[model samples]
Target: MTRRRHPSLWIAMALATSSLSGCRCSEPPAEKEEPAKASPTIQRGDAVLVEPNAGDFFEARVLGLEPAAGIQSLKLQRSDGEITTADAVDVYKLPDESAAAAASKQPGLAPGRLVICEVAHQRWVGCRIKTVSEDGYQIEDFGGEEHRISLKKLMLPSELTRMNLEQRFKIGDRRRAFEREAARAGQPAPPPGFSPGFKERVIAKRGDEWFSAHIVRFHDDGAFRVRWMADDRENDVAKVEVIPEPPYQQPPKRGGFVLLKPNVQSLPWARWRVVSVRPELVLQNAAGEQSQSSRREVVPLDPDVAASDEESP
Candidate 1:
């Protein structure tokens, strides 16, 4: 009879077969498992994976929902230690409901907290958040000048971001109006007899030639004056004088034009005469008697006139 086979061998054979069967059943499936459906979540000061491969992810804080864009833009801290922005479509909510609720109720930037001032003219400009009045915001510019801006002219930054050419023009017009008003308020008023619009004509004499200049002034007497710019400088610089016309020989009878004394210093060589005398030319003479001689002819006292008078003598 054959020797009885060892029990251990049979047991070993069964164990081997069982191990092979398990290996066949445990082989990995060919298809990949889809990532869990991402849920919107507020970011806590924690690092999380943002991408599918787990290779690229950013550390960010969940600021708020941007419903319009339909994307969550997180305030992120970059690897370089700088705060930047990152966005994701699928965001997940935190497991802690109370924490999320607290974040939602926290106060953030006020609706009208920030403003931008674009300078239309002049240097230095800034913006401020002021209480809204019926008129509009009371803003202080970079020059520390305070201005009341109309609501129509003021715009939110978000709104300004979308401004077109026409919108910018409107804003510019409003700024100009504010500047003009400020300038007017800060300037002193003109004196009773003085007018800001008064102008004067200057007559200068050189040899036999005459020249005229139109100067802008605050008074009819040419005080507080500015030099007139000549269109033709060479021709305008010739010698000239004021001369009185015929009607000025008689004293002025009623309220009418008066001749203003010309400044002799302005025209060294020119002799002044009251030219084109009006009804107001009547004035007391040196003898204390009213005389029409108040008006006289103004002429240049050139070398020729002096020589001729001497020769006549």
Candidate 2:
């Protein structure tokens, strides 16, 4: 039946319906959250720093990965050609570019300077600086291989000389101690040339290369401990690896002119003519004064200098 509904009641019902619909439309839809990105995994042939049992991290190349005892391990090869294994957790990948802004600056270090650098196997060898980098220095070794070395691994010639002198002094002290022990024991003096510090220079052969070096120790087993001049590195060498180097290679020739310190009391060297070389170097000055001297006491005069000396009254 079409019963007349109250106007107020109809309006209230309509408003109630509108309010419910507006409330439903007011809320925005819930959004879906994205997952966090994961880091790139380590792969083969990547340069990484690995820590071994020594607890020190060094540069190495990843050879491959292996599972040991249910834990992942990486096989790495060091710059020294040594292959080792470390847990994946101990390996860190190296960045393409160094994070440091600039390399540490040091005195006596510059591009093109010759230095001794520690490359493979912690062995120091001669290298030339190519450039500076935050990691260290870019250097080319004598073998033409390029490597980045830290500052502590680099040594200047002067610094190496200083170190060599210090090492020599230490060796000399040891020699003195040995001598004192021999004296106390009523033993005869150690054989000459068999003692340390016996020679100032020696030709030392190391790895197919002959180097000028100083004797650090002469062992009872006939082995020699020599310090190389090229890098001031000490190495134990066999007896055949070392030999005394004469003070002078070529002695003054007969009839040649030389600057000679005639005697131990002589303070300054004087120009003289070489009379004889064999037996001993006999010299005669411009005044016909004759004297005997060792090759080390004389400096050979250049041809031009000798000619000028002759031309002079």
Candidate 3:
């Protein structure tokens, strides 16, 4: 029996088959894989901002690595003066220092720029190179103490290394360049150490917080342009906001006494002599050989006390 289905039934079956085919054509396409991103390199003594989690960032200084834990492990000193530990994977260099220029394989290190070098016991200290030679680098630390640090131990700040300290100061706005020249002619000169390129700790008005920065240039009235290296920020801070951090190497007058560290491994309390002040505060004992003390470890004795120490047996 060539019994055929109704014409309507035949039409329904045809439509059903077409719909199934269309469903297959409408299937979603596979997604392509994205390329891998490169990770940033970080090392000890570099300034960085760390991210503990999503959206939270903290400013920190890299103390060093804890290889026993992992290559990614690091010791950090926070902006608030607190010392803590972190992971290298979680830390990132500042925008201006993203290239890790200081850590590069190139050969370029000059004097007068601030650099972080590994000091005694692998301690990282911020210092300026007084002299660079084939022998080694003579590092003048923040405390004004001098050290003979190896070239391999130095971590040159990318910005400061490539650019002189004077250039880093954002002197002014559009008219600042011309204004500086005009003002220099007639205005009373700023006192020494307050002039351009003087590094000091500044107190911010926003949070009344204290941070290290350097004077860029002096303004007509009393304002001074300053550069904050921690975040690569520059602005004008009032004279009042700027205060000098007394360096430990102040040379006292002849026949006068100054507080000093008794031994390389001792606390800074012993009263020492005033051989000369220029270049650096030179102190000595009955024995010869120049010794250095940290600014934090040294204190100045009042003239009255200094005189008494000198007169003492």
Candidate 4:
């Protein structure tokens, strides 16, 4: 059965339907899904700076990654054979050698580049460029000491390592050459107070006294390469600082008197008769007790001095 509807009611229903459709058309479009955030990646064997502790980063190689509890830590090894662990947040990638080299080539742009500097003689240390000058680059060390370094003394870490290894090989070769020269008939001894040359066993002056030493080689700069018998340390001894080992003298007769100093540091040289001269110098005092001393410690008495002492007594 058809029921009759009022005209106002029909018009109101149509108007409500039209309004709902318009609202749907004006709705904002669904937002596009954002791409998942990317995580930064670091691989094994990469050179990196790691801070095992807060605020203390050092150069190291990434050994591996350790993941635990949804967090990652880095296994890093330092140049000195020390292995340490650091959080991923504290690990930083270093510029590759190529990049570092390229940056170093532009000295004008080297204000913050990492570098190796030979700050003192044979002392290589890590540093950073602070500024550039017409003469050379000004560098600041890890300890905060600023230095004006010559270009020749500054290098990238990789370059310094290679150069250092080569230098060591060269020094080793020179040392071998020195050994060969020493093995051959030793060089002729020079006169006292004269400079020493290669392969000469000498009494080199250290402080005011002369000590037994030998010149085994020559420095690149022509300085005498002296090896002191006292400490076995090598030095670039200068001319006029070295002389031949003093010639040994014939021992006096058993009853003959000679001056001797039992203590090289003590005063008052005492008279003693010779007992033996081989192996070591043996002397006897008035009590007939024997004491041993080096042949070099025995000295001939000065007649004038002895006479003056006698006259004073």
- Report the number of the highest-lDDT candidate: 2
Go through the candidates in order and give each one's C-alpha lDDT.
0.32, 0.52, 0.46, 0.51
Question: What's the residue-level lDDT of 7 in candidate 1?
Answer: 16
The 10-residue segment of model 1 with minimum total lDDT is: 304-313
What's each prediction's TM-score?
A: 0.16, 0.22, 0.25, 0.28
TM-score, model 2 to reference: 0.22
Cα lDDT of candidate 1 equals 0.32
Report the lDDT tens digits of candidate 3 across residue range 1-313. 1211111211222122443453332444343210111123344566765545422346688777655332245688988889987655545454333334333434546777565555664355556778877767797654457899765555443332223222222221223443333233221112245333355443222133344466777787877787764565788877655543333234245434444533432122344544665666666542334554434433343322111111111
**Candidate order (TM-score):** 4, 3, 2, 1
Model 1 deviation from the true structure expressed as Cα RMSD, one decimal place: 30.8
Angstrom error at residue 118, model 1? 8.2
Candidate with the greatest TM-score versus the true structure = 4
- Residue-wise C-alpha lDDT for candidate 1, range 1-313, written one tens digit per residue: 1122111211222122433453332444343211111122233353322221111123234433232353334454544466655443322222234443443333332323433332232121234445556534676543335666543322223222213222333444455554443333221112223222323444333344233444443433444333432333322221113221111223322322223233343433222222233653443311223434343322222212211111110
Model 2 segments more than 4 A misplaced: 1-40, 98-313
Q: In what order do the candidates fall by lDDT, top score first? A: 2, 4, 3, 1
Off by over 4 Å in 4: 1-41, 105-130, 134-136, 142-144, 148-313
Regions of candidate 3 where Cα sits further than 4 Å from its true position: 1-105, 158-313
lDDT-best of 2 and 3: 2
Clashing pairs in 3: none
- Candidate 1: residue 279 lDDT (0-100): 51
Deviation in Å, model 3, residue 241 alpha carbon: 37
